[model samples]
Structure formats: C-alpha cells, structure tokens
Target: MTSVTSLPASEQEGARTSPEDPEKLEDPEKATLSTDPSETSLPNNKRVEQPTKINWLLTCVGLYLGALLYGLDTTVAATVQASVYEELGNLQKLPWVGIGFPLGSVAVILLIGKLYDTFEIKWLIIGSVTLFEAGSALCGAAPTSNALIVGRVIAGMGGAGMYIGALNYISIFTTSMQRPIYNALIGLCWGTGAILGPVVGGAFSDSSAKWRWAFYINLPLAAVVSPLYFLNFPRYNPQPEHTALEKFKQIDWLGAFLNASTFVLFILILSFQGPIWRWAAPGSIVLWVLFGLSLISYGLQQTFSILTSPERRLFPIDFLARRTLLLMFFATSSAAAATSVTLYYVPLFFQFTKGDNALEACVRLLPFIVPFVFFVMFSGGLLPVVERYAPWYFPAGVLMIVGGALMYKVSPNTYTAAIYGFEILIAIGTGLVFQTGYAVVAAKVPAHRVAASIGFINIAQIGSICITLAIAGSIFGNLGFVKLEHVLTGYGFTDSELRSALAGSFSPVFQHGDARARKLAIEAVVSTMGTSFALVFVAGAVTLVSAFCMRWEKLGLQTTAGG
Candidate 1:
C-alpha cells in the first residue's frame, strides 16, 4: 500500500506530456515545468536545450560518489576509535574526535543550502570537494589527536555542502519521472557508506599505522568525483544578478548563530551530564535554559521576518507554515533517530550479549544492513506505481515500531534466530522511510530553490540522529553504570575499579575473575541498552503520528513575500 513519493510536478498540474516509464527521463532542456512562465527568466532559445541520456547518467554517478564519501567518512572514523585513543592518550577528550565533524557540518548545513540557491551549484560542489580533500590530507598527516579532530570538522563542513550540492544536481539533471530511481541511488550510496564504514574501518584496526588510510581512502574518491562533476554537470545556473554585498546581506546570521549555539549546548550537556555532572547540576540546567531561550529567539526572528519582510529571514516562515513540510521534518527526524539508534546500539547488543568482537558484531549486522539497502531501492522502484509516499509511511513506521519493540523484548537468553528476525524487520522499515519524506519535500519545493528545501529536511534528519544518540547515550551510561556499580560492589570490586570500568564503557566486568560477577555485568549491560531501544519506539510513534498529518496532494512552495 505504499504511495509514490514524488510524481512529475507536471502530473500534478495536468501538464505531463507523457506517462513514460519511471526509468526514462524527459528531455531536460525541452521540458517545461509546472511553474508560472513568468517565473522562468532564461534567455530565448536557451530553454530548449535537451540533456542527452549520457550526461544524465554521468551526473548520477558523480552524485552517488559524493554521497558515498560522506557515509564512508562517518563510520571509518569510528572504526579507528581504539587506535585513535591509544595514539592520542587523551581518552577524556576523545569524544571531540567524533562530535567535532557533525557539529561543523551542522553549523553550516543550512547556510550551505542557501549558498546553492544564491550561487551556482557547480562552484559549490567544487568548493565542497576541495574542503573534503584538504581535511582528509590533514587527518592523514596529523601528528596529534587535536589535529585529527580539527581535520574532521573541516571535512564535515565540506561534506555537508557536498551532500546538498549533490541532491540539487539530482533534481536538476533528472526530470520528475526519472528522480525516484536516482533518489534510490543516493539512498544506496548513503546506506552502503554507513554499513561499509564499519567494515572498512575494521580493515585498518588491525594495525595502528593502517588507521591513517581511513582518511587517505577518501582522497582518491574525492579526486575522481569533483572534476567529473564540474565537467559533466550542465552549465545551468539560474545565475542571480544580486551584488556580492547584497547576497551577503541576505544571510540570516542571527538565526545561524542561534541554531549552531543551541545544538552545541545540547551536545555538550549530553556528552558530560551523567559522567562529568548530573543532569540537575547547575551547569546542565544553565545550558538547558539557554537552549530554550535560543530556540525562542530563533522562532521570533523568523516570525518577525515573515511579518516585516519575508526576504530577510534565515528560517523561511511561510515555508515552515506548510502542514505537509512540517510533518515531514519531524517525522523524518524521528525515523532518522530510529535508524541511527538501531544501527549503533544494536551492534553493541551483539558484542555485549554474544561476546562478538567489534568486527564480528558489525559483520553480523548484514541481515539488517542488506535488507535496508535493498528495500530503500525497492521503495524508489515502487514509487512510480503508487504515486504517493504517505501510505507507505505508516507501514514503514509500524515496522520500525514493531522491530524496536521486539528488540526491547530481548533478554540475555534471546535466541539467535529471533535477533536476526528483529534486525531484518528494522532494516526493512528504515528502507521504506529513509528517503520518503525528503522525496516529498524535494517534490514540493520551488524548482529554483530545491537545494535549500532539501537542506532543511536533511538538517532535521542529521540533527535527530545526533540528538537521539545523545539522549539514549546519556540514559545508557547513567543506567548501566548504576546497575554495573551495584553488581560489582556485590562482587567486592573496589570503588576505583568501578570508576575505571565506567570510563572504559564497563566492558571489564565481563573479564572479571568471578564468573557470577561477569554474568551479572552482561545482564546489566543488556538492560541498559534495552532502555535506549525505548527511544527508538518513541521515535517510531512520532513518525506514525506525523504520517497521517502529511498532505497527500502537491504542496505549495510555501513562498515568502520577497521570494
């Protein structure tokens, strides 16, 4: 019963010239979209240029490579964690190595989207690739952990921009009829990168020197893709005539600062709350309060722009007003959180409960990862037949909920078959929902500004992943530590030993002299990780609620006055 994620805008407007195969694209140059003719400002005769099939195919390959790099970077860094810890010897600061990249990407993600709308997509793609290469080179050559962390941040900033730029090209290079297949391609690259990150990262973890290759590998990929993008992508910039100063003035710095600062505050609090300071501590409380205030200020800023002058807003008020867009943002956010949680903590479950090594645990996740990759591709293929995303949203979300509930029900003795079944269910659900909302958003946004619209949805998706990780992480740490401490104390383990175990993620208890203590420790770890699955359930429920709220029809572009 899944619905099509995006139909030809032409179909919605009764302007579709052909109900062609979804695999086929209309002549990009000859295709006139559903928008007002006055809105098109292209010079005479320029509008009729058709993109040959070969150009479109190359463009898809280029965009897929771009997506793969980002996903690959994310997991590869994690796979090298232990080597990084040993090399740096500053275990306390290690969180920054991972957190820095996402923060840097988040800081500029929305801003980067706006850049695409205001500037040429080609230059932005080129700039993003340059940043990625520079960062990778820095990391490969880093002499200290601090240097590596900084390199990750720089790389992330570029990755975010590149990701947005890639999506923008997908929309432009392909007609609506052709978009779903390519959307599936993007999803495949992203999902494969995620799953492959661990596999590839594991390859280097066997030796300390090999860790550098984790960063170095991205270099060749970036080299191949960037030039291909510039040369192959059409010279199709809307080419705004606004002055440099004028374009700069259009940025909503106040909103940007608020958004970045608020997220930073949240990340810091989550990172240290239970381990370094209790949640109710004055520092945590102050940060939480400031976060609330920052959000309020951001809301007010957008509202003021909407009423006074819409063109100046950092957050587009009118666009946010659309009911479908709003639901998609939060719904996808929940779904993203669910996928992140399942991919991450589920593996932890395998390692803790089954005593699998990191590599083994990750490899065993094939049941989940394989279905995820295929089903996402399946969802795209099915879109042409269904013509709507809403109906599919419910079943996908329900599977997520069911999958999560099954995982939550697992005990220390849960059978291997049951675990595999649960993982498969979750992966299938993730496949169905992963790109559904974004496809809807891309379809609904004005063709001219698709980059920003897609960017905003991506922000929600990535932000949800991080935020859910933080919340689930905090709860897992607090609860696991509490249980592990009690169990270890009963086994006569010293307080210093307990503190050390907490810092080391409580894996030592499984290696203790007493078999009884080790058993108790495993149970404690499983219980704590189970609580995190509850967050997945909550996220699934959120998506389920949001699915019904999304409009089934073509949405307005939600334009502001200046737009």
Candidate 2:
C-alpha cells in the first residue's frame, strides 16, 4: 500500500481505485503512519484514523444492536401468532403480521441505500434508530391486528436502514483484511438474534406480559446502546458541497415508486390468490395486472429516467447485471427463502404435531439454532483464511437439499428424534451462506459503489423473505383449511372456524372436537406443512445452480490507510 503522507494534499484526501482492477487487495493490519488530517475521508476516497480500541468496541456494540434488531424482528412474530390471535380475532389478516415488516423494508430499502452515499451517515443512523424504536413501542401498545401490522411495517422500514447501516459501518471503518472477521461477527449477532427471536417471543407470550412484551423488550436495549452511535461513529459525507435539499433531490422518486408498487402488488396477489379469492377472480386479476405494469414501468424508468442520473438511481441496475453479481443475487435469494421459511414453520410444526404451547414449541428449535449459529461464524471465519467464497455454497446447497427432502417426508407419524436431527442439516446449510454475500459484494464492486452493491444484494435477501413467506403463508393457511374442511365435513365447522384454527392451535373448535376429529386435524396440518417444505427443497436446488455458476477466485480486500 502507498503511504498517504507522501502524496499531495488533494491526492491524499481523494485516493481511490477503480472497479476494473483485476487483483484483489488484502489488509496488512498496519497502523496509520500519517498524522495529516486529509488522510481521513469517505469510504470512496481516503480512510480516517482508527479510534481507540475501547471506542471502536463501543461503536461496534452500537452497530451490532441494529443487526440484532433486524434479525429479531424477522421471526419474533412466529411464535406469538397464537397469543396474538387470541387477543385480536381477525385471523383472516394473519399473514399481514409477518408480511408487514419485510414489505416496509423492501419498499424503502433502495432509497435508503442511495441516501447513505448522498448524506452524512451519522444523522441517517440516528434517524433510522429512532424510527425502529418508535415502531417497537407502537407494536407493544397495539390494540388490534391492523395496528400491530402497521407497527411491523414501520419497524421493517427502519430495519432496512439499520441493516444497510451495519454493512456500511464495517465498510468505512475496517480494513479489507479485517472485514471478513468483523462481517462474520455481525453475522454471528444476526443469526443469534434470528434463532432467538421465536424463543423470546414464546417466553413473553407464555408469561403475564403476553406477546406485547416481545416488542417492548427492544426499547430498553436500544436506549442502552444508542449513545454509542452518537458518540463514536466516524463522519462520512460524500458530497459536502451539496445542501441537504439538493441531496434529497437526487433521489429517483419515479423508480422508487415503481419498485415499491411492483413488490406490494406481487405480494398482494400471492396473499389473496387461491386463499381469499379464486385465481380467476377480478380482484386477483387486477392485482396481477398492476404488478406486471409496475414491474415494466420500473424497468423503463430505471433505464431512461430523466429525473435522476444513473449514479443517483435507487438500484445499481447496470452494475448488478455483471455475471458474478447476478449469480450472487440468485444464490442469496434462495438462501434467504430457505432460511425464512424454515424459521417460520419449525415452531409451528412442533406446536401442531406435539400439542406444545408457544414456549415449548419454540424451545424445541435448539437443534436447528445451535448448529446454525455455530456454522454461520464458521463460514465467515473460513472465507477470509481460504479467500474462496464459491466453494462454501456446495456443502450449504447439499445439506439444505438433503434436509429439505427429509423434512418434506416428515409426517405426523415421524419420530420427534428424527425431526430434530433433520433440522441440523438445513441449519448448517443456511448459516453457511447467510451473510457471506455482503462480503463478496463489497469485494466485487468499486470502492465508491460498495454501498450500492451491498444494498442490491440485500434487495434479494429481504425481498425473498417477504415474497416466500407470503407464498408459504398462503399455502399453509389455504391448503390446511381445505384439508381440514374435507376431514371435518358434517362436523359442522364454518369457514371462519377453520381459518381461526389454522392461525393458532388454541381455537375453540379444536377443543370442542372429538378425539377422532383432533386426530384428523393433526394429519391435515402435518400434510400441509410437509407441502410447504417443498419450497425449501426447490430453494436448495436453485442454490446449487448458483454455486456451480460462481467464479472460483480468491476474494481480496482493498482499503485506504486507516482501513
């Protein structure tokens, strides 16, 4: 690496390498030798001095809190469904509870990505944290199902910012060589929070505070870590000369609107089609048409938008069109779908098949969670030393395929021991690739385009979770209802009764049913759940295609002086 002090002031403050460089760079772990203030700048240019070890540690804590919250919110509602259904009886809108968060995230995430590059990162972080905390409070205090869903959407929007911010912080503050370690650590926190979400939700639901405290718990932790963000974060302003209003004007509003509407319409179609309305119904047809139109408009607008330059577009449209990055996006989407569907259904499986309460059902997931947490760190650690990102996906894909196949065969008759064992394979598989894609994107893009590249990959990650969960929910709810109706024919259950039973095991109809009726209901649920796992099987298969398509190359890091 060149010494910053030897360069002229202008060069020292704005040194950068283009994305076309063939050789990958790595960190030497050297201390900054220059005392010049110009050495410190934005990630696209120069890096600043390192904070004291204690100060960096505090900053990391603040950053990891965002990651934790992002992961926690992903599945906290999984185990709380029954408790929520009991308190708020609109079981018809149940999928919205899970869909709301990811919807909010996918809608605004692209804009948030562009904002990080255009404005000072510190204020954005503060604003995002404030939104997340406020949303958490609203969720805890919500009086109805609709209110709860609205709160979740707000939290998801904030979470989209925080998720990108976590990666953004690591990108700016650390050396490329050190990034693998730090990125792996963030993955550790995120995976831990993800698996623990259901456990915490279950615990809260079983206690006197009920499901509401599941959200309330975030407030105290956010309060504790927020000061670190304010005090320790490095300032980054890419365009200091531009006013805030000018920066805001650079956003591609048309592209953003089209992107958001496209996603919203697609999810609506999935949520309603074949469940609430027939596929040929006018309502479904209208949603499908709007979704297609929105998608077409987004593409056209992105390609020829007069409102914003290519640099200011919400998505890194041309950049991600590159072969390697495109493969990464597909692989990432599959991995995300596999993980989200598994996490959402595992607890529900135990609850339905074993007659377990929310707490017991969630606790039963340790088999999957334990290995998942371990291997996520393992993959992150291994990637840096080996410097090979592609091969890791092989084992991940194989394990997920095998696990998904085994899980798909799981009936109500399957042994509990076997079910527990089957989960480990999928857990190990998913944990291997969950966050590694971010590191790869950072390595692949130009220094200035790292934020946009990472955000684009995240679009796949968050979008898959939203789309797959909506599809999976539709499958589970509708299929299970049909099967239950067939079995309980002449038992005199209404459509609402069947739908309520699908939402939670605590429905009064289930209690009123005879032993024969209960037995048939369990069969219906297990079979429907087994069908849902087929999506996991397909995800694993698609992941293998990505793994084989990836380039077998070492991922080298590039960093400025302090970095």
Best by lDDT: 2
User: Model 1, 413-472: lDDT tens per residue?
Assistant: 999789889888888877887876666766555454355567778788777766776777
lDDT computed for candidate 2: 0.79
Candidate 1, residue 381: Cα displacement in angstroms equals 1.8
Model 1 spans > 4 angstroms off? 1-52, 141-144, 207-209, 306-309, 490-513, 552-563
Q: Relative to the true structure, how large is the alpha-carbon lDDT of every model? A: 0.68, 0.79
TM-score of 1: 0.85
Q: Against the true structure, candidate 1 has what lDDT?
A: 0.68
TM-score of predicted model 2?
0.92
What candidate 2 gets wrong by more than 4 Å, as runs, is 1-16, 19-50, 557-563
